[model samples]
Target chain A: MDTNPLDNASPGHGPVVALFVTCLADLLRPSVAFNSIKLLEQTGCRVVVPLQQTCCGQPAYNSGDYESIIPLAKQLIAALEPADYVVIPSGSCAGMICHHYPQLLDGDWRDRALQVAAKTFEITSFLSDILPIKRGHRAAIKLPSVTYHDSCAGLRELGIKEQPRQLLQELCDTELSELPQTEVCCGFGGTFCAKMPEISAKMVHDKVHSAQTTGATILAGGDLGCLLNIAGRARREGVDLEVRHITELLCGDLDGPAIGEGE
Target chain B: MEQHSDTFLENASKALGNKAQADIRDLLGLFTPLLRNAAVDNFEHFEALRHHVKRVRQHSLDNLDHYLATYEQQALKNGNRVHFANSGDDLNSIVLDICQQHNAQRIAKGKSMITEETGLNDFLQRANLDVMETDLGEYIIQQAGETPSHIVGPALHKSADEVRQLFLQKHDLGERELDNTEDIVGEARQILREHFLKAQVGIIGANALVAEDGYSMLVTNEGNGDLCANLPPVLIICTSVERILPRAEDATAMLRLLVRSATGQSQTCYTSFYSGPRREQDVDGPLETHIVLLDNRRTEILASDYREMLQCIRCGACLNHCPIYNSVGGHAYGSVYMGPMGSVLTPLLSSLEESNALPNACTSCGRCAEVCPAEIPLPDLLRDLRHQETVEKITAPRWRIGLKLHTWLARNPRLYHWLTGVGIHLLHLAGRKRGSFRKLPLAGGWTSQRDFPTPQGKTFMQQYRAQRKQS
Candidate 1:
């Protein structure tokens, strides 16, 4: 690994980015949050985690309980409202706040929701779009050849197809294997995986098969929900492949066993 | 024809379990997107044309009453009789009456999804009239006593071997083996020619109806639509009222997207427009002509929040791109329409109780919306239907309660973190050895299919706070 002195200091004064560790990353995989912060801070930014932040109300929004999503939206807006920028590690959650929050919250809260949404960004896009991280300065980490799965929300809703791939190509010293139908979903639609498991299984099964066809030993994605779903299915079906968040490999923090692989 | 949409889960389960059908599903998954993408790339102005067609359809729908009246007047001037049917049963009875008045038998039919929606073939057969499906895909499914599985390619789910077996059982051809696709096509053509020549009345579906000249447009690859429309003494056109356009130019705008999106062709082999019966100057045409416009709950769809769905041109691009439709095939929808469009339209046209599971089948991937030529936001519409399901209390009470509890907890950040943190810590300890659970309470839907991975020891929020303090 090439250690180029990863520092959290900006060139002169970096923007204050409140790290919005999504509910999935908060509960299931904390490393994604750490890696995201590392990546953000390495590009010269002040990072803070608002303690009051919780779920993004995506579960309720997707389940058609719009009535219940209002307070959650309000909670997110109030907590992240003070930051210069709110950065998210997961695209699904980022997409919810950026695209769905303004639509879900109404009346007086709608303007605040939109304001919060404007500052929110998925981590990779935040580094690339807002901060303009120099490619040569990235820490060079060697990783196994991997195929990237574009989470549907991030890819379609937020136009996040190229930012992560660009980061992996410029930073990582490994082959970026391209999977067929990379834009197709892995069927991990939050509560969707639990509610419609059979269809979800078949979809993820096809996704894994496509990834394997690229001869990639690992699958990397932006969303923890998709990574968990794909990794869990791969493990269940005895497929010999590892899954990881792209940020974990990008931040050079690949010490733990791959997702769904260890005690 | 039959409302088995209530058994969507059972049908999907059965479709998933079949290995041979799985192979066909895989082929379709690979084939359709390639064709559609190639067709789209071939045209430089496809996006612009899509927008124009969307506006035209929207404009027509807005002024639907004026266009309908103009079409009625123009059609009457062109010597064609127009009739309206309020429901599927009414449409069937009107057609039955027309056939009875003509003493019609041996009806040659072109591919018509509206006919399938109304179950007209079975009704006519019950009335002792011979209804022969001339379209090859329709003919194959008809012989098998099955409904069309796809809108455009009715027998797409059937493999060549399946079709061969179906033919061998149904056809009385001599010991000659009919194994190849060419042989099957030849046999079907020969079989259908007899029906085409002897039929007294022909029935075909209109792709679009022009209010300007009272003309109905029919598009086909096999030229069967032409034969059905012109080779009989009386011609009857069946279509939904939503198929009307204000001008022939508007129909042209829609055709640009329809043909390419439906079959990946710049244009179909045969696109014919008919106004009325044969006049004294006409050499070859029907002596009598009639157009039967079916409502069939479409007016309700027009009046409801789902009015955007009426903009659909039945192109099947949404169906082709839908992942769930590819997995389960069209039969699982158990309705005349299938895929994303079907999930939205079936519930509105039929009862929500019968097709409740259709909307839940979506993963909200948004591919259907991405490829829609009509620019219908199908995922949004499906979500609206799901919202309707919740408001109407059609979803299971237990599921609703679970969602309610989740919402309440999510609204309270402290309670949400405390409860989930404890829950994850316990789950991590319980499945530490295996790193996964084969069985779990309240997650049988997930665990039944694959092992649910155990959460890492502490939640990210807990770790983040500790790390922040240490720093």
Candidate 2:
């Protein structure tokens, strides 16, 4: 059952997308990429995975190494050229490519960056916006209580806090407790975690503690970096829980992942 | 202790490391959910109120000079003397001069960050005037001889035991044990009561100065602001220029957002409007009122890239929701302003050069912006400031050079990937068996606290393209 409204790429309504498998989806989490494809393709849009796409330069840009970020940015701009829209799964990556990258390439591709930016939508937003297809859950899978952590980028930069949750509500008949500090950062701020270890450790610990208190068996969010941070801390603390991206659960492809299973 | 705009960031950061900041951050994280839930459930009119507050702030910013003048005129018409300060030094002098002219010896102050900005207490203490903070939190920190950590809850960092000890040390009590929150409040109230009644000048911060009313709307949970503004013979208001609103009703929209967003209170227990000096037959109010509009780099901020920073209502929601502030906390930023707003304002009020650490303290998370009733684009503003820091060449030299090198390679992905892949391969080889490294030389911070996982056999991009080709 193709739940995606983007299953058919009608130029009249379907968007030609520059697929941005954000830095995390590109480096750390690959299935989020495959899951992203199934989700986007199901929606009826033409997804183009530009091979020239590299890091959106968020790591460098955030580290105040803007100069180092510019060229990577220019390369990405050139790779996704002529796409009517650019779709990304991760909010942090989407935020970087859509929000910060354009500012870096202000002189040459400023207009192009701005143009691509306007059309760039997160996969969940694309599902909610361009797709809006009725969600078809893969067989009824019962789960214990869970809550959604609104990634800062997805919530603030993209206003994607609700769309994923709205979509997730249909996936299973599970207890959903809105995360207490859902809007607060789980502290995976690219290099910030490295720059300030004590602070980062304490913050991740607190986030895990708060999530645990909700009595939810599963914690989910959009960005993998934050999920990894929370999941790592949850495992380190030996809390009984599973952490997964909203997409993996939305696709019902999530399996065999205990906290810190891969790491 | 003259305030230095330059030392804002370094001071803030160091202060945040005082160990107390962590405790405060933990506490703040706990209390924050309360406000966020209230904001979301306003199911009644949260969005409308958010829009209303945003519109009010926008209106105030555009017609600022006009509103300030209107507030001044209204205040003067109500027999309040209005003086403007272009800098902290000017504000301090105006306050001191007012105190001196009025023969003020002992003063009582409510919680006023602007007074802290002016270093007014230190200034008054230097001149041999006995100054006391009447707010319970302010009084606690005053006794502890520390600056206020959180804006709304100044003594929020201090635990009950610490306060018990501070109160015991400050007062000659044989066995008056501060058992709970109510006891602490009672003790502080009793101590500050005389000061409030007998002080020559009672100073307070105005939440919103209504331009049409010639009055100041001062909000406080304890009603201390009213006492501070009304008790003494000469009452003075030390506030920044942006506190002025178009009318009393305009503030209703903001007040609707402010209290609800601040402490989750539908309305604070006490909301008082003080027009001016007491009328002839008034039972008990100040004989004279003074309005000190403290600019102190605000005009420059208005002229600079940070004009929107003026829209802050000082509700401290940003501090509560800020992850950086939650982790490092406010004191680490070292500037008087801490949290998200401090990261932006500290540089402006202080110096961009000295406060370079402040702007970089953010994760560019939108939590602060989302929770902010004022709807200030805090993350965007922080990024813009960082950009300004880069363009202005105020950032550390190493960062600039590193950025230069990164830009050079990143322009060519093949080269960038080759270099990173080689580096990645070396790291993977170095930590293969363990699947993660507890410590890596280059990223010592990651190693210091936790492990960094080796990028498995292939990066996601590598697998992504291969999978795409197969399809």
Q: Among these predicted structures, which one has the highest TM-score?
A: 1
Query: Each candidate's iRMS in angstroms?
Result: 1.9, 3.7
Q: Estimate each model's TM-score.
A: 0.97, 0.86
Which residue pairs of candidate 1 clash?
A: A26-B460
Give Cα-based local distance difference scores for all models.
0.86, 0.75
- Proportion of native contacts kept per candidate: 0.60, 0.39
Evaluating just chain A, the predictions reach TM-scores of 0.93, 0.88
Candidate 1 on B91-196: residue-level lDDT in tens?
Answer: 8998889888999988999999999999999999999999999999999999999988889999998988889899889999878687788998898999999889
Instruction: Pick out the ten consecutive residues of candidate 1 chain B with the lowest summed lDDT.
Output: B460-469
lDDT of 2 by residue, B1-471 (tens): 223335544444454566765665667677775765666586488887787877887788888888888888878989988998988889888888989998889999998999987889998899999999988888888888888777888877788888987888888757876888788778888888978889999889888889888787888898888888877888888888888888888777778778877788888888988888889888888898889888887778888768889889988888887776766555556657888888888888877777776777777777788778888889878877787788888876666676576566656656665666566556546655654555557667665655555554456655544564586
Runs with alpha carbons beyond 4 Å of true place in candidate 2 = A1-17, A38-47, A64-74, A100-111, A127-129, A132-149, A162-180, A209-221, A231-263, B1-25, B281-283, B421-433, B460-471
* Candidate closest to the true structure, highest DockQ: 1
Among all windows of 10 consecutive residues in model 2 chain B, the one with the lowest summed lDDT is: B1-10
Candidate 1 residues A33-104, lDDT tens each? 888877888778877777777788777677777777787788778878877899998888888888888887
